[model samples]
Target: MTEFTLIPASGAAVPAEPFTGRHLIDGLWKDSADGATFDRVSPSHGVLVSRSAKGGEAEVLAAIAAARRAFDAGDWSFSSGKSRSEILNRVADLIDRDRERIARIEVLESGKPIAQARGEIEGAADIWRYAAALARMAHGDSHNNLGPDMLGLVLKEPIGVAAIITPWNFPFLIVSQKLPFALAAGCTAVVKPSEMTPSTTVILFELLEEAGLPAGVANLVLGYGDPVGAVMTTHPDVDMVSFTGSTGVGKRIVAAASGTLKKVSLELGGKNPQVIFPDADLDAAADAIAFGIYFNAGECCNSGSRIIVHEDVAEALTDRIAVLSRKVPFGDPLSDATQVGAIISDEHLGKIDGYVREAQAAGAKVVIGGGVLAVPGLDGRFYAPTVVAGVTPDMAIAREEVFGPVLSVLTFKTEDEAIELANNAAYGLSAGVWSLDVHTCLNFARKVRAGTVWTNTWMDGFAELPFGGVKESGLGRELGRFGIEEYLELKTVQMRVARGRNNWVAG
Candidate 1:
């Protein structure tokens, strides 16, 4: 087995924090109606980071009213696309300027590796830039030859009062994915970020406000999901809802939105597959698999949790994966040498531990690092990079989303069986295939039932690509042009070219 050195955490100097708690509503920061507050905890040390206003029904309603007023008053929708694009570009620049600070906050609040947080910060900034460039390109179409004396055209206009709800994982990046596009499409928005990690979102709103967006164009509310999230989804003033989270909660959001027939776009959960063929580059395959499942402690919605390898090469691949998993250093996120940071909370840690225990009880072999690791001098939620072999498809860990640093290895007989096992799950969000053979790669890519397929790689994403799922994974799309289209409505206009107008009844 080849040993690889972990990249030391970057000790980059971060800027002095300029923004804190307080929600951004109507271009200003304020407390909730009842003055209730929630503590922001540092998942790295399990300490209180700060306190933010705990928004509830009254706060959510205020945000909705502000958004509705902004849309109906035509402050944002009346602006030209070029104007919107310019403001978005400015916001992107501001994000870049504060990237280091934002990355630090992300690392501190979410307990992700500093390196991964930096990448997420960069990705979020790029999404803003991409959405900015797309702002001026929301063009409508003109239809010719509708009739000899009639001219027709189709127009795309902004959907009013968008409600954006993002998950705790990739806090800033996921919110950026939807918020920038919503603003670019000339829609007013109320953002509800997960309470687990709201610091980055609060910083983002400060940057948005600094970008000089019109008053009431963007609002922020922080609270628990059930009350605040439900209010946002069910509010009549909210025209559309864009959410990213677990599939179980997504169904509830759908049910709530159905009452008013509100537009909805959900990016839900996944039990993604990483298939390794016999001809794959063993070293790269093992490394990719390790990073795919262990990165951010496998909190990603598109985490490659299931490993479907060809039976001939399954033993070799499993051995290599186990070796790699051992090398994944689990420690404080602030340490530059830490590769795997702590899980979000103790509840999530217990959930992941339960999955491992259940899988072991079901006769799966615990190959390496299958439980919690108590590091000296580190008091936080931590889980070791776990690998389970001899896992059957019927095992709970093999079928459900463990959402932790846990990987289940299953074998397949052939390419057809690999695709079958990969697509057998209820999720169709993301999948990865590793093969040196071009034909095998193409076949797997074409046959896989996932929104994003990586050939010879894993978890490589950009803001320019559209991402979502089929089946139970999600509805609609995020990022790229598709993201912008989600916040728009289409309308058809027709005009007659008669020289003299005459009433049909009079004639």
Candidate 2:
């Protein structure tokens, strides 16, 4: 296989765009009011990629006001579903058309492998199309027999302006998870993408505008979480907030939204488990579980960090996982051959390494790779795929969300013990189960407290699956019909067929 330690941006295979400090608001691209900016560097090489607008409270307010105005004007909120479908289709077409440019921007900032980045871009396109279909299929319930004298109709109405704050790890894909659904429900939105990776979202606005999306239907404000995210979450005009990030931040958003009692949908962190029964295909289970955690450098909130194997097969599965872990190529994100790329940044890389070291100090054994890997001629933030064994559920590495390429292997003596250990974490986002027996897989998955379960599979998600979590993992859901429901409110219309006014209240 061809290999290279580092390649200059000039020689990068992907096409480059003119990255700038512009955030779209009210259908116009403008500099932040204070003219301040933040540098966005490629995590692959720690080199400056572009300067982005560091929007603050002033911009946040402007965007919210714009969204509120657009909703109140009924420009998009009252449009025919067929018209909305056409617009959404055009938006998807643009995404597919510019997939290469968008994928390149995603890899540069988010540090995802080129192939995965491309996949995310294409996946987002599919989501847009699926959401378009949902727009046309927003069916409401009709009750013709509520009462002989009474007629009732339950209608779903838009929940007004939404504040969409997405995380750095799947910048474009995460936004697609929320934004398109809100639009499908005819809700206008003011979005705040992670400052670390705002290029793709900013570019997305250009496409939405080209798709004939009305001015202020969707707005993007780029900035850090504090002044920007905090303000947007609490903004009185914003009727809803859909956030995907840390559970800590998710809590703050809920608190901030309490003032307005706005609807909140949170897709947060997880310490997801991968359970392997003794009767499972150990080899296949090991490889799939390793990929579950290592995909996207293990920045996934649903990373299957807790690999709970039955005692009978724990040693063998752990060994197989170590072998699979080593084969994952960690290098330049632009390299098509690279399966694992750099961490989001230096600070994030340090946090990941710290977690691994702490786990090792607590009596956990480092199976294969446990530290950061170097890329010659460059100080890129790359961490090796790590497999740690002899871990207890009480260990911080097992309980916490590392969001890195580190796996903790724990053993269980019985199915009951495995279930207990898996549910010990404060998170319950998702889980995976592997077993040759269909009954075992189904029963075990049903017992897990997570939102989604994969029997004999891992890290598989589609636009049609309702994805979310219980407990502290998150609130509400995204994707499928449920995603659109989060942006709508139920209204009942009742009328008396007798045409006689009842004076019971007055009497």
TM-score of each: 0.95, 0.96
Report the C-alpha lDDT of model 2 over 1-507, residue by residue, as the tens digit: 222233223346433544785888999997989998998888886667778989988898999999999999997998878889899999999999999989988888888888999999999999999999999999678888977788888999899999999999999999999999999999999999998999999889989999999999999999999899998888889999999999998998899899999989999999999888999998789878878888998999988888998989888888888777767777878878878888998898899889889988999998877877776545578787888999988889999999999999999888888888888989999998888999888888889999988988888889998999999999999999898999999999987887787687875
Full-model lDDT for every candidate:
0.87, 0.88
- Using TM-score, give the best candidate's number: 2
Per-residue lDDT for 320-420 in model 1, tens only? 98888877877767777787887888889899999999999999998887777765566667787788998999999998999999999999988898999
| CA deviation > 4 Å runs, candidate 1 | 1-20, 500-506
- Checking candidate 1 for backbone clashes, the offending pairs are 9-336
Candidate 2 structure, TM-score to reference: 0.96
